[model samples]
Target: MMLRTIKRLSSRPVHILGLSTYNYSHNSTLSYRKLTTSASSQTIKREEQAETATVKKEEPDEEKPKLSTMLNLDRAQMEKDRLARLKRKKSDDSHVPQAKHIKTLATQTLTFKKEESVDPLPEPSTSRRGPFMTLRDLQERVASYVPRHTQYLDGVVKKTYVEGRERTPNDIKLEEVFQKDTLQTAVLSAYVWEFLWVLQKLNVGECDLVLVLHAKEDEMVHHYRRNLCNIPRTRLCFPNMSGNVNCMHSKLQLLFHLTYLRVVVPTANMTPYDWGEALGTGRSEGVMENSVFIIDFPELPKTSATPDSNPSHTHFSRQLLHFCKAKGLPADIIEKLDKVYDFSRSKPLGFVYSIGGSHHGTEALKNGVCGLATAVRDLGLKTKKPMEVDYVTSSIGSLNKEFLLRMFRALHGDDGKISVQGIPKKYSSRQLAEPAAAADESTESESEEEDQSDNKLWQDIRSSVRVYFPSRRTVAASKGGIQNGGTICFQRKWFNSSTFPQSLLHDCQSVRRGMLMHNKALLT
Candidate 1:
């Protein structure tokens, strides 16, 4: 019975030390032995198999697949919600109102701030790194250097024509030139800062203003409104221009008085720099000098007829009307001036202008080079000799052989006789008298001969012509140096061209040696 009990105990699974031998009781005679029997072995194997199965099941829960991708869709969804909330908050805040006075001032301040920041001032190519300067600051700097009392217009008071190095004689301030109460209205045209400086110069606050400028319609209006808001009445006129037209480069002023209308054509712009303003100190002074042609036309009597109908209508008056008409000025203004003013006094002075257009036939003889021809003819200038031509200028265009030739021909009061379709028709009567074939052949031969003659004449004219401009050396050594010469430009491509007359080029040595010249003049 004891043996049976031992065998039964061994058949059951061992709890301690796995399957190792152990003595359960000290009194028992049966020796401990390995539990290698089939029943015991089967029981031990079944327990181990159950433990491994459990471990396998738990491992799958802890370990994850390495190739699996994590999703961030929820994060993206949260970010979108955050942005939507921010937009709603901003919209809600915008509906809130503020005090009226504070709001008005704030709005104006913001408007100006925004405007000032919109257009970035370009840094000059030659400018070095430094603290930035605003346009207003630059204007003040330029104005500071100018002499306070530049004009001494009393010619009889000053008999000596020459003033010392620092002083200028016979100077006239634009502001002092106009009579205060007598000035009724004014017309002003210039290159830069037209409204700002000119309005103060004229001192015609109550007068009606007619401003001619070159800019887009909206831009021009905005500029005028920004600068001249206090003016009582204003009119803006743009020169009639096409894509090929370069610029509206004329500077003119018209002042209407109680008894007369005064016209002043000046070589200077509205800026202080162009009107006897210097950029240097003491003896080494840089000056911008310009000349003016001023004329006063008397108001006609009421008994006289309109200028168009009157026999006394001078060439200058007719041309002025034509120019106004071409530039798209107010018809009523032109008519009023024509009817009221007598321009007979202006006959002694010649008005030369360049209006942009592709004019043909006889109409070509009315402006630009052709207009110069007309002026020379009217003035009765003798051009029979081989005339020497000298031209001084601040700006140079893309000059070519053809342009120089035409200019030479124009100076001699000739049409240049270029072969264009409509121009030949001006003398079509001569062609009509001959047979059709003969006329065509004769015209061709005549044109060829004329061209040869023109080529020969061009060679002679080219040799005699000279152009004076500020060279690099001249500009660098000036009182203001290269910075003030920004307005003068001549492209390298034009100068480098084969057809450019390089031999005739000369440096413009101003009388005031250190001063830069912004003058444009032609001498024959």
Candidate 2:
């Protein structure tokens, strides 16, 4: 039983072993399957984690583009808003001030418009007479009437032939005493006749009184006989002396007595003293003063004359301040006179007087007229009186209606109206033409040419005067020195007496030099 059992056991054992092996194989297979499943599950988990990481990295890039676009839009919107605000601010600021200015302008315009709309107009008068009358009418109503013509003596009235006078031992011999006197009388008479002839041509009337102021003794006596006594003796008044002090006094006294209008004959050595003497003595106390006018005759220095020789003897300017001081004239009067009597203002009048007075030196004539005008203006202002001033030319024969008409036209005519091209049709014909026009044109042209020539005459005169009168060296020494090495000299070639037609030296050198120096110092 044992043996059999052993054998069966062995076989059974083999079978059991085989079954165990099979079971082992099955277990291995199952284990392998589980491991494979576990491995696959791990791999799937790793894949899922990698995919998640990649998706996270990719998500930032995608979001970055979207954010950049949104940011750009936001920035554009912000810039637009800022621009809009600035534009609104600028518009507000510009509108505010402009609106205010426009409103103010509109208000001003409206005010002016209303003012113009409400203004009133006056009614015209029905009177037949015109509002403005001529100056002549007023003069006639106010002026005193006097005889048109008066007789005057022809020559010096000698005491020998007086009504009842007999020849006396005191009278000098006729031949010895009267030889020069007679010749002078004759020459003066001729001059007077020529002057009267010229006056007749000018158509002067007899009502006008001829005043001789500051004339030389000989000239005064001569003119008195020839012109004053011969044509209209009653219409003449002699101041009796050549000095300014006497002349002024005579003028004033005559004005009060005759009640006649007189014209002044300004000559060399006539000063403000003469003017004041003649004009200042009128109507002080309940007295009817005469109407007097001034006819300025300015004389220039002689060609041979010098500033150092003394202009006081020949020029009335030196007496101006002295007269003012004596008369106690105000400073304002002096200042006004200086300004109004400037050369530029007095040139036209000065030219007339210079030519009439036969003044040769252009500068002297200009200076004299300027000084006289200044003195007259000052005197008038101080006295509160307006004196009529007329420029009388030696060429003008007389003071007539036609002469006055011509003068008025000449003074008031437009610029260039008196020229040759401006002659009127009526005046173009010889019969109806103004006789004086041609002469006046010639004279004017000559005067213009003379001005150019005479411009240096005064400078030459001053130089000559300085050289001739060395006494003025001290005056010049203080002001550095004289020009041209202290040798002041003038040439005769520069002098033109025909065109100028005036005497520069009427008296001695001492008088002339003193007068010139006095005037120079004062002017300087």
Candidate 3:
């Protein structure tokens, strides 16, 4: 029984070893399969993660450009809003009441005083039997009355004899020569009185007259008026020794109404040719040998002067005395004269004559203007109220219009129809008309060029665009939101479905081209 048990135990050992080996092989196969499966799953997961990371990186690149575009649009919108606000503020400020005072002052009229005195002169009866006087008649009247002797020629007499009196058995003096003293007396007695009558008829009250004299024979008339009319001479004289004086005259008719008078005199040694050129071409036509005159009316009072209790007769006498001393005249002459008549209290009607006065330079002209202004001011002060001063520099064209206007405003308070309102309107109209006329010419040219260019550009752009109709399938696909389609398919299905007329296409192209060109021009 021992031998048989040993044999069975050895066989059982062999069986147990075989079973252990089989179990080990099964466990090894299961572990190898699990390792391979796990490695494959990990590799798949890594590939998927890398693909997702790549997609995310590419998405930001596309979104970055879109973000930049959005930012630019926001900035443009903000700038537009800022400009709009500024425009609104400017518009609001313009409506405020600040320019109204200037407007009111610019439209005020000038004020003048009423005349108080009248001379007991006989009025002339109107006669309609005579024809109107011609230029020849005026020439004849001037030649017959004015003396041949002139101060300008230093007392030289120029004569023209009548026809057929050149040679004779006994040569007779054809031209008549009168003594200076006799001529002066005659002018003072007859011509001056007539001139004064003309002045008195105008009713200009207590104004100064400017008499321009050039040692010409015509100046004798002015001298006679000055000596006989008893007008006082102002201390101021023109720089050029032109025979001219500014006499105080009260009325316009007295100074400007004479058709035969030579009102303006040039003392600057200018010939007729030179004078013609200086004045302007074509101005010398029909100019006769006549004298020039300016009737400068005194300024009305802006504010009244305080009258002295004693009327300061001493000051008045002293001023007269000084004037006499300066002119080297005897003060007793004034004393011997009778006080003919006093119009306004302490204010005498006077005249000034400038013999060879030349207001050429800036300083001389300024002084002339200032002297006139002061004279007007003194008259205004006498009245004790605000007044207007009218400045008529010369009836002749020798005076500068701009300079005269400036002088007028400087003397007056720039408050009158002639000063602030009337003059500015005339000047502004001239200033505005020039630019407006020029702009009209340029605008017409530019508008025509722009229209032609726009038409050409529109024709070119219209030729480049292509359009077509879409199929039913493409339309159905687009309606289903299908993404797989060409741009042509989408455009044909939606945009080209509607037939655009030739007129409409042309208009759209034209508008687009015009808008593009306009924007480009503005940017440039």
Q: Judged by lDDT against the true structure, how good is candidate 3?
A: 0.25
Local accuracy of candidate 1 as per-residue lDDT tens digits, 160-238: 1111234444444454344433456777777675343354444233356788887645566666556444344667777
Please provide TM-scores, in order, for all candidate models, with all chains considered together. Answer: 0.61, 0.16, 0.19
Error of model 2, residue 351, in angstroms? 20
Look at candidate 2 and tell me the lDDT of residue 208.
27
User: Considering lDDT, where higher is better, how would the candidates rank from best to worst?
Assistant: 1, 2, 3
Model 3, stretches more than 4 Å misplaced? 1-332, 335-344, 348-367, 380-394, 413-524
For candidate 3, the per-residue lDDT at 90 reads 38
Number of the top-ranking candidate, with lDDT as the measure = 1
Ranking by TM-score: 1, 3, 2
How many backbone clashes can be found in candidate 2? 37
In the range 1-524, model 2's lDDT, one tens digit per residue, is 00001111111210100011112122322121111222343453343244322323211221222222212223234334434543553454443232243235446745743444211111112222221323553344335322222101111111111111233322111121112110111101011122321222111221222333334467656654563443321233333233333323221111111222111222211122111111122211110111122222122324533533433231232343233333323444333222222122122221112112222222221223333333333333223122222231111122222223222222322121222122333333332234667756654674475346444543433232211222334324422233311222223333332333122222212221211121111110
Local distance difference test values of all predictions, in order: 0.55, 0.26, 0.25
Which runs of model 2 end up more than 4 angstroms from their true locations?
1-194, 197-203, 213-223, 230-234, 239-523
TM-score: the better of candidates 1 and 2: 1
**Counted clashes in each candidate structure:** 0, 37, 44
Model 3, C-alpha of 318: deviation from truth (Å):
7.6
